[model samples]
Target: MASQKIATLVLVLGLLIMPFSIASYAQIPCNTVYNDLYPCLGFVMGGGKVDPACCSGFKTVLGLAKTKTDRQGVCSCLKSLVSDATDGEIKNAAQIPKLCGLNIPYVISRNIDCSK
Candidate 1:
């Protein structure tokens, strides 16, 4: 009975700590970026103006990227999303920061070396 109780306590402690560890591992959640930018798919595809919400979302993601690793993660996430987009769509995505009056340091492109 004591062994079972100790095992249960260990399991509970592991469960409690799991979320904090995962949260620390991924400082920026990519899903947030996807949710924020999904509204801009039409604009990115070259059919319409960027939505205010999209710009807001982009800014939020940009603000959250406070480190080099975070920035690279964002870039990698974006690259995967844009892989299926047309050349024009990719171009529009690359230009979003400029058009939105934001100042992102790196251009959004699949060709970018995220490791840097």
Candidate 2:
């Protein structure tokens, strides 16, 4: 009876957790961000008004980050991109979210620790 109860409890727990696990695993691809945000590069590097497409891309990326792991994945991708960016571009990146009227939790910087 005790063994049956344990098995039933385990099955219940698994069923309860399955949907969350699936949702967590369904993060947007990192490459998708690169493709979406590509239009922002010219403005980010050149000190001009960001394009409307750039803002739309930023909104899409923000919307995809529904979990902590997803957010961290984005941070990692941003870190790599920023590493290759000019200082001016990095500055522009930091301002992009605010400029777009979006509230992102992580600052866009090469030095930001994405592990958090």
Please name the candidate that would achieve the greatest TM-score relative to the true structure.
Answer: 2
In candidate 2, stretches whose alpha carbon ends up further than 4 angstroms from where it belongs are: 1-26
- On the 0 to 100 scale, the lDDT of residue 17 in model 2 is 35
Cα lDDT of candidate 2 equals: 0.70
Task: Give the lDDT of residue 12 in candidate 1.
Answer: 33
What TM-scores do the predictions have?
Answer: 0.72, 0.74
Pairs clashing in candidate 2? Answer: none
lDDT tens readout by residue for model 1, 20-106: 322234576556557667666657755568888778888888888899888877776676566555566678888888878899767
TM-score (C-alpha) between model 2 and the true structure? 0.74
How big is the positional error of residue 72 in model 2, measured in Å on the Cα after superposition?
0.5
- Alpha-carbon RMSD, candidate 1: 14.0
Candidate 2 lDDT tens digits, 1-116: 55643543354334333333322333755566666676676577565898888899989988888888888877776775666555766898889888889898878987988778
